[model samples]
Target: MIASYEMKHQVPYYECDATGHQTLAMLFRLLILASEDHSDALGVGTAKIKEYDGGWVIINYAGDVDRLPRENETVTIKTYVEAYNRFFVVRTFEVYDADGKQLVKVKGMFAFMNLTTRKVASIPEPLIVPYQSEESRRLPKVARPQLMANDLAWERLDYRVRFFDIDLNNHVNNAVYFDWLLDPLGGEFLRHHRLVNLKMKYDHEVRAGEKVDSQFIKIEEKNQIITHHQIQCQGKIAAEAEFEWKLV
Candidate 1:
Protein backbone atom coordinates (compact mmCIF):
# COMPACT_ATOMS: atom_id res chain seq x y z
CA MET A 1 0.00 0.00 0.00
CA ILE A 2 1.18 3.50 -0.72
CA ALA A 3 1.92 5.43 2.43
CA SER A 4 0.66 8.97 2.93
CA TYR A 5 2.44 12.05 4.27
CA GLU A 6 0.95 14.49 6.76
CA MET A 7 1.75 17.94 8.10
CA LYS A 8 0.14 20.35 10.52
CA HIS A 9 -0.25 24.13 10.17
CA GLN A 10 -1.65 26.99 12.18
CA VAL A 11 -3.59 29.37 9.97
CA PRO A 12 -2.07 32.79 10.47
CA TYR A 13 -3.68 36.16 9.81
CA TYR A 14 -1.81 36.63 6.57
CA GLU A 15 -3.16 33.41 5.14
CA CYS A 16 -6.67 34.42 6.05
CA ASP A 17 -9.04 36.79 4.31
CA ALA A 18 -10.41 39.97 5.82
CA THR A 19 -13.26 37.90 7.27
CA GLY A 20 -10.75 35.64 9.05
CA HIS A 21 -11.32 32.64 6.77
CA GLN A 22 -8.48 30.97 4.92
CA THR A 23 -8.09 32.29 1.39
CA LEU A 24 -8.25 29.78 -1.43
CA ALA A 25 -4.79 30.78 -2.55
CA MET A 26 -3.31 30.09 0.89
CA LEU A 27 -5.11 26.77 1.13
CA PHE A 28 -3.44 25.66 -2.09
CA ARG A 29 -0.12 27.03 -0.93
CA LEU A 30 -0.43 24.80 2.12
CA LEU A 31 -1.08 21.76 -0.08
CA ILE A 32 1.91 22.52 -2.30
CA LEU A 33 4.13 22.89 0.74
CA ALA A 34 2.91 19.60 2.16
CA SER A 35 3.57 17.87 -1.13
CA GLU A 36 7.04 19.33 -1.32
CA ASP A 37 7.75 18.15 2.21
CA HIS A 38 6.53 14.71 1.21
CA SER A 39 8.94 14.69 -1.69
CA ASP A 40 11.80 15.75 0.56
CA ALA A 41 11.00 12.85 2.87
CA LEU A 42 10.86 10.44 -0.07
CA GLY A 43 14.39 11.38 -1.14
CA VAL A 44 13.35 12.86 -4.52
CA GLY A 45 13.08 16.51 -3.81
CA THR A 46 13.29 19.20 -6.53
CA ALA A 47 17.08 19.16 -6.67
CA LYS A 48 17.07 15.39 -6.91
CA ILE A 49 14.54 15.41 -9.73
CA LYS A 50 16.57 18.02 -11.60
CA GLU A 51 19.43 15.53 -11.62
CA TYR A 52 17.27 13.53 -14.03
CA ASP A 53 16.48 16.67 -16.05
CA GLY A 54 12.89 16.53 -14.91
CA GLY A 55 10.59 18.94 -13.12
CA TRP A 56 7.20 18.25 -11.60
CA VAL A 57 4.36 20.34 -13.00
CA ILE A 58 0.82 20.24 -11.78
CA ILE A 59 -1.66 20.39 -14.70
CA ASN A 60 -5.00 19.85 -13.11
CA TYR A 61 -6.83 20.36 -9.84
CA ALA A 62 -10.29 18.99 -9.07
CA GLY A 63 -11.70 19.57 -5.64
CA ASP A 64 -14.48 20.50 -3.23
CA VAL A 65 -14.23 22.58 -0.11
CA ASP A 66 -16.51 22.02 2.87
CA ARG A 67 -15.31 25.21 4.56
CA LEU A 68 -12.24 27.34 4.97
CA PRO A 69 -10.51 27.21 8.31
CA ARG A 70 -10.66 30.32 10.43
CA GLU A 71 -7.58 32.34 11.30
CA ASN A 72 -5.58 30.79 14.14
CA GLU A 73 -7.18 27.38 13.55
CA THR A 74 -4.83 24.45 13.59
CA VAL A 75 -5.29 22.07 10.66
CA THR A 76 -3.80 18.86 9.38
CA ILE A 77 -2.72 18.49 5.73
CA LYS A 78 -2.17 15.10 4.13
CA THR A 79 -1.35 13.75 0.68
CA TYR A 80 -0.80 10.32 -0.86
CA VAL A 81 -0.01 8.88 -4.24
CA GLU A 82 -3.24 7.86 -5.90
CA ALA A 83 -2.16 6.43 -9.24
CA TYR A 84 0.26 6.92 -12.13
CA ASN A 85 0.86 6.16 -15.74
CA ARG A 86 3.74 6.40 -18.15
CA PHE A 87 3.39 10.17 -18.19
CA PHE A 88 1.26 11.34 -15.29
CA VAL A 89 0.73 10.92 -11.57
CA VAL A 90 -2.36 11.79 -9.56
CA ARG A 91 -2.00 12.68 -5.92
CA THR A 92 -4.84 13.25 -3.49
CA PHE A 93 -4.79 15.82 -0.68
CA GLU A 94 -7.03 16.42 2.29
CA VAL A 95 -7.22 19.00 5.06
CA TYR A 96 -8.81 18.43 8.41
CA ASP A 97 -9.88 21.06 10.89
CA ALA A 98 -9.03 21.05 14.57
CA ASP A 99 -11.99 18.81 15.32
CA GLY A 100 -10.86 16.31 12.67
CA LYS A 101 -13.57 17.24 10.22
CA GLN A 102 -12.59 17.22 6.58
CA LEU A 103 -12.43 20.76 5.23
CA VAL A 104 -11.05 20.23 1.72
CA LYS A 105 -10.27 17.42 -0.68
CA VAL A 106 -8.33 17.74 -3.93
CA LYS A 107 -6.84 15.55 -6.62
CA GLY A 108 -3.89 17.01 -8.46
CA MET A 109 -2.57 15.59 -11.70
CA PHE A 110 1.11 16.08 -12.34
CA ALA A 111 3.38 15.63 -15.30
CA PHE A 112 7.10 15.14 -15.27
CA MET A 113 8.53 17.71 -17.63
CA ASN A 114 11.88 18.29 -19.26
CA LEU A 115 12.97 21.58 -17.78
CA THR A 116 15.13 22.45 -20.78
CA THR A 117 12.56 21.72 -23.45
CA ARG A 118 9.57 22.53 -21.26
CA LYS A 119 7.73 19.52 -22.61
CA VAL A 120 6.01 16.65 -20.87
CA ALA A 121 8.32 13.67 -20.68
CA SER A 122 8.13 10.01 -19.82
CA ILE A 123 8.09 9.17 -16.14
CA PRO A 124 11.55 8.37 -14.85
CA GLU A 125 11.86 5.11 -12.94
CA PRO A 126 13.70 6.71 -10.08
CA LEU A 127 10.76 9.02 -9.63
CA ILE A 128 8.05 6.37 -9.94
CA VAL A 129 9.93 3.67 -8.08
CA PRO A 130 9.45 5.42 -4.76
CA TYR A 131 5.73 6.03 -4.96
CA GLN A 132 4.67 2.39 -5.61
CA SER A 133 1.28 3.51 -6.83
CA GLU A 134 -0.82 1.36 -9.10
CA GLU A 135 0.41 1.69 -12.66
CA SER A 136 -2.21 2.04 -15.34
CA ARG A 137 -2.06 2.77 -19.05
CA ARG A 138 -5.29 4.70 -19.00
CA LEU A 139 -6.25 6.97 -16.14
CA PRO A 140 -9.66 8.50 -15.80
CA LYS A 141 -9.84 12.13 -16.91
CA VAL A 142 -11.44 15.06 -15.17
CA ALA A 143 -14.66 16.13 -16.82
CA ARG A 144 -14.42 19.06 -19.21
CA PRO A 145 -15.87 21.93 -17.24
CA GLN A 146 -19.00 23.69 -18.34
CA LEU A 147 -17.83 26.37 -20.70
CA MET A 148 -18.57 30.07 -20.41
CA ALA A 149 -21.31 31.37 -22.66
CA ASN A 150 -19.60 33.66 -25.10
CA ASP A 151 -22.88 35.24 -26.06
CA LEU A 152 -23.25 36.68 -22.62
CA ALA A 153 -21.43 39.69 -21.27
CA TRP A 154 -18.23 38.98 -19.36
CA GLU A 155 -15.89 40.90 -17.06
CA ARG A 156 -12.16 41.03 -17.62
CA LEU A 157 -9.05 42.31 -15.91
CA ASP A 158 -5.46 42.41 -17.08
CA TYR A 159 -2.34 41.75 -15.03
CA ARG A 160 1.31 41.98 -15.88
CA VAL A 161 3.03 38.82 -14.68
CA ARG A 162 5.60 40.08 -12.21
CA PHE A 163 8.96 38.54 -11.42
CA PHE A 164 7.58 37.43 -8.08
CA ASP A 165 5.03 35.35 -9.95
CA ILE A 166 7.76 33.02 -11.13
CA ASP A 167 8.95 30.19 -8.92
CA LEU A 168 12.47 28.84 -8.53
CA ASN A 169 11.95 26.89 -11.75
CA ASN A 170 11.04 30.21 -13.42
CA HIS A 171 7.44 29.24 -14.11
CA VAL A 172 4.28 30.88 -12.84
CA ASN A 173 3.19 29.34 -9.57
CA ASN A 174 -0.37 28.32 -8.75
CA ALA A 175 -1.27 31.08 -6.30
CA VAL A 176 -0.95 33.91 -8.81
CA TYR A 177 -3.51 32.26 -11.04
CA PHE A 178 -6.08 32.48 -8.24
CA ASP A 179 -5.45 36.18 -7.90
CA TRP A 180 -5.99 36.67 -11.61
CA LEU A 181 -9.06 34.47 -11.75
CA LEU A 182 -11.01 35.96 -8.85
CA ASP A 183 -9.93 39.57 -8.89
CA PRO A 184 -12.37 40.42 -11.65
CA LEU A 185 -15.24 39.61 -9.36
CA GLY A 186 -15.96 42.66 -7.28
CA GLY A 187 -15.61 42.49 -3.55
CA GLU A 188 -19.35 42.71 -3.04
CA PHE A 189 -19.80 39.56 -5.10
CA LEU A 190 -16.93 37.69 -3.46
CA ARG A 191 -17.75 38.58 0.12
CA HIS A 192 -21.26 37.18 -0.12
CA HIS A 193 -20.51 34.07 -2.16
CA ARG A 194 -18.58 31.05 -0.94
CA LEU A 195 -16.78 28.67 -3.22
CA VAL A 196 -17.90 25.06 -2.93
CA ASN A 197 -16.49 23.19 -5.93
CA LEU A 198 -13.74 23.92 -8.41
CA LYS A 199 -12.06 22.40 -11.45
CA MET A 200 -9.04 24.00 -13.04
CA LYS A 201 -6.60 23.03 -15.78
CA TYR A 202 -3.36 24.69 -16.74
CA ASP A 203 -2.61 24.47 -20.45
CA HIS A 204 0.30 26.84 -20.89
CA GLU A 205 2.79 28.53 -18.63
CA VAL A 206 2.78 32.29 -18.15
CA ARG A 207 6.24 33.68 -17.67
CA ALA A 208 7.54 36.89 -16.13
CA GLY A 209 6.75 40.13 -17.97
CA GLU A 210 3.86 38.65 -19.91
CA LYS A 211 0.45 40.32 -19.87
CA VAL A 212 -2.40 38.07 -18.83
CA ASP A 213 -6.05 38.79 -19.54
CA SER A 214 -8.43 37.29 -17.05
CA GLN A 215 -12.05 36.86 -18.08
CA PHE A 216 -14.93 35.55 -16.03
CA ILE A 217 -18.67 35.14 -16.48
CA LYS A 218 -21.16 34.52 -13.75
CA ILE A 219 -24.20 32.28 -14.08
CA GLU A 220 -26.82 32.30 -11.41
CA GLU A 221 -29.12 29.42 -10.64
CA LYS A 222 -31.39 28.52 -7.78
CA ASN A 223 -29.48 29.50 -4.67
CA GLN A 224 -26.15 28.70 -6.36
CA ILE A 225 -23.71 30.45 -8.68
CA ILE A 226 -21.21 29.21 -11.23
CA THR A 227 -18.26 31.17 -12.57
CA HIS A 228 -16.19 30.30 -15.61
CA HIS A 229 -12.76 31.86 -15.89
CA GLN A 230 -10.12 31.99 -18.59
CA ILE A 231 -6.60 33.27 -18.18
CA GLN A 232 -5.09 34.09 -21.52
CA CYS A 233 -1.72 35.40 -22.52
CA GLN A 234 -1.30 36.88 -25.99
CA GLY A 235 -4.62 35.43 -27.06
CA LYS A 236 -3.66 31.87 -26.10
CA ILE A 237 -5.32 30.44 -23.06
CA ALA A 238 -2.96 29.72 -20.20
CA ALA A 239 -5.54 28.30 -17.84
CA GLU A 240 -9.25 27.45 -17.69
CA ALA A 241 -11.35 27.14 -14.56
CA GLU A 242 -14.90 26.61 -13.35
CA PHE A 243 -16.04 27.35 -9.86
CA GLU A 244 -19.29 26.71 -8.03
CA TRP A 245 -20.39 29.03 -5.28
CA LYS A 246 -23.37 29.36 -2.99
CA LEU A 247 -24.92 32.46 -1.51
CA VAL A 248 -24.55 32.60 2.23
Candidate 2:
Protein backbone atom coordinates (compact mmCIF):
# COMPACT_ATOMS: atom_id res chain seq x y z
CA MET A 1 0.00 0.00 0.00
CA ILE A 2 1.17 3.52 -0.74
CA ALA A 3 1.72 5.81 2.24
CA SER A 4 -0.34 8.97 2.52
CA TYR A 5 1.16 12.43 2.98
CA GLU A 6 -0.32 15.12 5.23
CA MET A 7 0.16 18.82 5.92
CA LYS A 8 -1.44 21.37 8.24
CA HIS A 9 -2.66 24.79 7.17
CA GLN A 10 -4.30 27.72 8.88
CA VAL A 11 -7.05 29.34 6.84
CA PRO A 12 -6.30 32.88 5.66
CA TYR A 13 -8.71 35.73 4.97
CA TYR A 14 -7.79 35.88 1.31
CA GLU A 15 -8.96 32.32 0.78
CA CYS A 16 -12.23 32.72 2.63
CA ASP A 17 -15.75 33.47 1.49
CA ALA A 18 -18.08 36.21 2.72
CA THR A 19 -19.08 33.87 5.54
CA GLY A 20 -15.47 33.74 6.78
CA HIS A 21 -15.06 30.08 5.80
CA GLN A 22 -12.80 29.02 2.98
CA THR A 23 -14.38 29.10 -0.47
CA LEU A 24 -14.73 26.00 -2.63
CA ALA A 25 -12.12 27.37 -5.00
CA MET A 26 -9.64 27.75 -2.16
CA LEU A 27 -10.49 24.29 -0.92
CA PHE A 28 -9.68 22.93 -4.36
CA ARG A 29 -6.41 24.83 -4.44
CA LEU A 30 -5.42 23.43 -1.07
CA LEU A 31 -5.95 19.94 -2.42
CA ILE A 32 -3.74 20.76 -5.38
CA LEU A 33 -1.07 22.14 -3.10
CA ALA A 34 -1.16 19.01 -1.00
CA SER A 35 -0.78 16.82 -4.07
CA GLU A 36 2.08 18.92 -5.41
CA ASP A 37 3.90 18.71 -2.12
CA HIS A 38 3.38 14.98 -2.01
CA SER A 39 4.71 14.62 -5.53
CA ASP A 40 7.77 16.63 -4.59
CA ALA A 41 8.37 14.38 -1.63
CA LEU A 42 8.34 11.38 -3.96
CA GLY A 43 10.57 13.09 -6.54
CA VAL A 44 7.88 13.25 -9.22
CA GLY A 45 7.05 16.95 -9.02
CA THR A 46 5.83 19.06 -11.93
CA ALA A 47 9.36 20.06 -12.91
CA LYS A 48 10.31 16.42 -13.28
CA ILE A 49 7.15 15.59 -15.23
CA LYS A 50 7.80 18.54 -17.57
CA GLU A 51 11.15 16.99 -18.38
CA TYR A 52 9.16 14.19 -19.98
CA ASP A 53 7.11 16.64 -22.07
CA GLY A 54 3.89 16.09 -20.16
CA GLY A 55 1.74 17.42 -17.34
CA TRP A 56 -1.00 16.05 -15.15
CA VAL A 57 -4.52 17.20 -15.89
CA ILE A 58 -7.55 16.62 -13.78
CA ILE A 59 -10.40 14.80 -15.50
CA ASN A 60 -13.01 14.67 -12.74
CA TYR A 61 -13.63 15.60 -9.10
CA ALA A 62 -16.28 14.16 -6.75
CA GLY A 63 -16.53 14.98 -3.10
CA ASP A 64 -18.56 15.74 0.00
CA VAL A 65 -18.09 18.54 2.49
CA ASP A 66 -19.31 18.58 6.05
CA ARG A 67 -18.32 22.22 6.47
CA LEU A 68 -15.70 24.70 5.39
CA PRO A 69 -12.92 25.77 7.73
CA ARG A 70 -13.12 29.38 8.89
CA GLU A 71 -10.42 32.03 8.76
CA ASN A 72 -7.46 31.26 11.01
CA GLU A 73 -8.77 27.77 11.70
CA THR A 74 -6.08 25.21 11.18
CA VAL A 75 -6.90 22.06 9.24
CA THR A 76 -5.00 18.92 8.29
CA ILE A 77 -4.91 17.67 4.71
CA LYS A 78 -3.99 14.11 3.79
CA THR A 79 -3.58 12.86 0.21
CA TYR A 80 -2.25 9.83 -1.62
CA VAL A 81 -2.27 8.02 -4.91
CA GLU A 82 -5.02 5.45 -4.61
CA ALA A 83 -4.74 3.60 -7.90
CA TYR A 84 -3.66 3.87 -11.51
CA ASN A 85 -4.22 2.35 -14.89
CA ARG A 86 -2.61 2.59 -18.33
CA PHE A 87 -3.80 6.15 -18.95
CA PHE A 88 -5.45 7.39 -15.77
CA VAL A 89 -4.78 7.80 -12.06
CA VAL A 90 -7.09 8.06 -9.09
CA ARG A 91 -6.18 10.09 -6.03
CA THR A 92 -7.99 11.08 -2.84
CA PHE A 93 -7.77 13.87 -0.27
CA GLU A 94 -9.18 14.21 3.21
CA VAL A 95 -9.38 17.40 5.28
CA TYR A 96 -9.79 17.39 9.01
CA ASP A 97 -10.36 19.97 11.74
CA ALA A 98 -8.24 20.38 14.88
CA ASP A 99 -10.69 18.11 16.68
CA GLY A 100 -10.00 15.36 14.10
CA LYS A 101 -13.39 15.65 12.47
CA GLN A 102 -13.34 14.95 8.73
CA LEU A 103 -14.46 18.17 7.05
CA VAL A 104 -14.00 17.28 3.40
CA LYS A 105 -13.43 14.12 1.38
CA VAL A 106 -12.54 14.23 -2.31
CA LYS A 107 -11.40 11.88 -5.04
CA GLY A 108 -10.12 12.96 -8.43
CA MET A 109 -9.39 11.24 -11.71
CA PHE A 110 -6.34 12.49 -13.59
CA ALA A 111 -4.60 11.84 -16.89
CA PHE A 112 -1.27 12.82 -18.31
CA MET A 113 -1.24 15.24 -21.25
CA ASN A 114 1.54 15.58 -23.78
CA LEU A 115 2.57 19.22 -23.61
CA THR A 116 3.61 19.42 -27.26
CA THR A 117 0.39 18.05 -28.72
CA ARG A 118 -2.01 18.62 -25.80
CA LYS A 119 -3.31 15.08 -26.10
CA VAL A 120 -3.83 12.33 -23.55
CA ALA A 121 -0.77 10.15 -23.01
CA SER A 122 0.03 6.94 -21.25
CA ILE A 123 1.28 7.14 -17.68
CA PRO A 124 5.04 7.41 -17.33
CA GLU A 125 6.68 4.86 -15.06
CA PRO A 126 8.99 7.40 -13.47
CA LEU A 127 6.00 9.41 -12.34
CA ILE A 128 3.94 6.54 -10.98
CA VAL A 129 6.53 4.22 -9.53
CA PRO A 130 7.71 6.50 -6.74
CA TYR A 131 4.15 6.90 -5.42
CA GLN A 132 3.89 3.10 -5.02
CA SER A 133 0.18 3.19 -5.92
CA GLU A 134 -1.34 -0.12 -6.85
CA GLU A 135 -1.36 -0.71 -10.57
CA SER A 136 -4.76 -1.95 -11.64
CA ARG A 137 -6.21 -2.97 -14.97
CA ARG A 138 -9.58 -1.58 -14.02
CA LEU A 139 -10.85 1.26 -11.84
CA PRO A 140 -14.19 2.25 -10.43
CA LYS A 141 -16.45 4.61 -12.34
CA VAL A 142 -17.03 8.08 -10.99
CA ALA A 143 -20.41 9.78 -10.82
CA ARG A 144 -21.22 12.00 -13.79
CA PRO A 145 -23.04 15.32 -13.94
CA GLN A 146 -26.69 15.04 -14.99
CA LEU A 147 -28.46 17.28 -17.49
CA MET A 148 -30.56 20.11 -16.17
CA ALA A 149 -34.18 19.14 -15.89
CA ASN A 150 -35.29 22.50 -17.25
CA ASP A 151 -32.96 24.15 -19.77
CA LEU A 152 -35.04 27.30 -20.28
CA ALA A 153 -34.46 28.44 -16.69
CA TRP A 154 -30.67 28.42 -16.95
CA GLU A 155 -28.93 31.73 -16.27
CA ARG A 156 -26.07 32.25 -18.71
CA LEU A 157 -22.92 34.33 -18.52
CA ASP A 158 -20.17 34.83 -21.09
CA TYR A 159 -16.51 35.04 -20.14
CA ARG A 160 -13.32 35.34 -22.09
CA VAL A 161 -10.52 33.02 -21.05
CA ARG A 162 -7.81 35.16 -19.50
CA PHE A 163 -4.06 34.74 -19.83
CA PHE A 164 -3.72 34.27 -16.10
CA ASP A 165 -6.10 31.33 -16.37
CA ILE A 166 -3.46 29.40 -18.27
CA ASP A 167 -0.91 27.63 -16.15
CA LEU A 168 2.67 26.60 -16.91
CA ASN A 169 1.48 23.80 -19.18
CA ASN A 170 -0.48 26.35 -21.27
CA HIS A 171 -3.96 25.14 -20.34
CA VAL A 172 -6.59 26.62 -18.05
CA ASN A 173 -6.02 25.26 -14.59
CA ASN A 174 -8.80 22.98 -13.41
CA ALA A 175 -9.38 24.98 -10.25
CA VAL A 176 -10.31 28.06 -12.28
CA TYR A 177 -13.30 26.20 -13.63
CA PHE A 178 -14.89 26.31 -10.18
CA ASP A 179 -15.18 30.06 -10.49
CA TRP A 180 -16.75 29.90 -13.94
CA LEU A 181 -19.11 27.20 -12.78
CA LEU A 182 -20.27 28.94 -9.62
CA ASP A 183 -20.34 32.58 -10.72
CA PRO A 184 -23.51 32.16 -12.76
CA LEU A 185 -25.55 31.61 -9.60
CA GLY A 186 -25.17 35.33 -8.76
CA GLY A 187 -23.97 36.84 -5.48
CA GLU A 188 -27.32 36.59 -3.73
CA PHE A 189 -27.62 32.84 -4.09
CA LEU A 190 -23.94 32.25 -3.46
CA ARG A 191 -23.99 34.18 -0.20
CA HIS A 192 -27.07 32.36 1.04
CA HIS A 193 -26.03 28.84 0.08
CA ARG A 194 -23.28 26.54 1.33
CA LEU A 195 -21.83 23.85 -0.92
CA VAL A 196 -22.25 20.32 0.45
CA ASN A 197 -21.26 18.19 -2.50
CA LEU A 198 -19.83 18.46 -6.03
CA LYS A 199 -19.41 16.41 -9.21
CA MET A 200 -17.52 18.03 -12.06
CA LYS A 201 -16.00 16.67 -15.28
CA TYR A 202 -13.78 18.13 -17.98
CA ASP A 203 -14.55 17.21 -21.56
CA HIS A 204 -12.31 19.70 -23.38
CA GLU A 205 -9.74 22.35 -22.68
CA VAL A 206 -10.58 26.08 -22.76
CA ARG A 207 -7.64 27.90 -24.20
CA ALA A 208 -6.76 31.55 -23.75
CA GLY A 209 -8.81 34.13 -25.69
CA GLU A 210 -11.68 31.73 -26.26
CA LYS A 211 -15.16 32.90 -25.35
CA VAL A 212 -16.90 30.60 -22.90
CA ASP A 213 -20.59 30.44 -22.06
CA SER A 214 -21.25 29.48 -18.44
CA GLN A 215 -24.81 28.37 -17.81
CA PHE A 216 -26.67 26.94 -14.83
CA ILE A 217 -30.07 26.43 -13.23
CA LYS A 218 -30.98 25.95 -9.58
CA ILE A 219 -33.39 23.20 -8.47
CA GLU A 220 -34.61 23.53 -4.91
CA GLU A 221 -36.06 20.58 -3.06
CA LYS A 222 -37.16 20.10 0.54
CA ASN A 223 -33.78 18.99 1.81
CA GLN A 224 -31.23 20.38 -0.60
CA ILE A 225 -30.75 22.72 -3.52
CA ILE A 226 -29.11 21.38 -6.68
CA THR A 227 -27.42 23.39 -9.38
CA HIS A 228 -26.29 22.03 -12.75
CA HIS A 229 -23.68 23.90 -14.79
CA GLN A 230 -22.22 23.60 -18.28
CA ILE A 231 -19.40 25.53 -19.89
CA GLN A 232 -19.13 25.74 -23.65
CA CYS A 233 -16.37 27.07 -25.87
CA GLN A 234 -15.87 26.92 -29.64
CA GLY A 235 -19.34 25.45 -30.00
CA LYS A 236 -18.53 22.38 -27.88
CA ILE A 237 -19.13 21.47 -24.26
CA ALA A 238 -15.92 22.13 -22.38
CA ALA A 239 -17.12 21.01 -18.98
CA GLU A 240 -20.13 20.07 -16.85
CA ALA A 241 -20.77 20.12 -13.11
CA GLU A 242 -23.47 19.66 -10.48
CA PHE A 243 -23.37 20.98 -6.96
CA GLU A 244 -25.49 20.25 -3.89
CA TRP A 245 -26.05 23.02 -1.40
CA LYS A 246 -27.87 23.79 1.83
CA LEU A 247 -29.05 27.17 3.13
CA VAL A 248 -26.53 28.91 5.29
TM-scores across all candidates? 0.95, 0.93
Tell me the tens digit of each residue's lDDT in model 2 across 101-177: 99999899999999899899998898899888888888766677886554467789998889999987577878888
Spell out the clash pairs found in candidate 2.
Answer: none
The lDDT of each candidate is: 0.87, 0.89
Name model 1 segments beyond 4 Å from true. 149-151
RMSD of each: 1.4, 1.8
Shift in Å, residue 39, candidate 2? 0.7
lDDT by residue (69-100, candidate 1, tens digit) is 89999999999888889999988999998789
State how far residue 246 of model 2 sits from its true place (Å): 1.2
Clash count (model 2, backbone only): 0
Q: What's the C-alpha lDDT at position 163 in model 1? A: 85
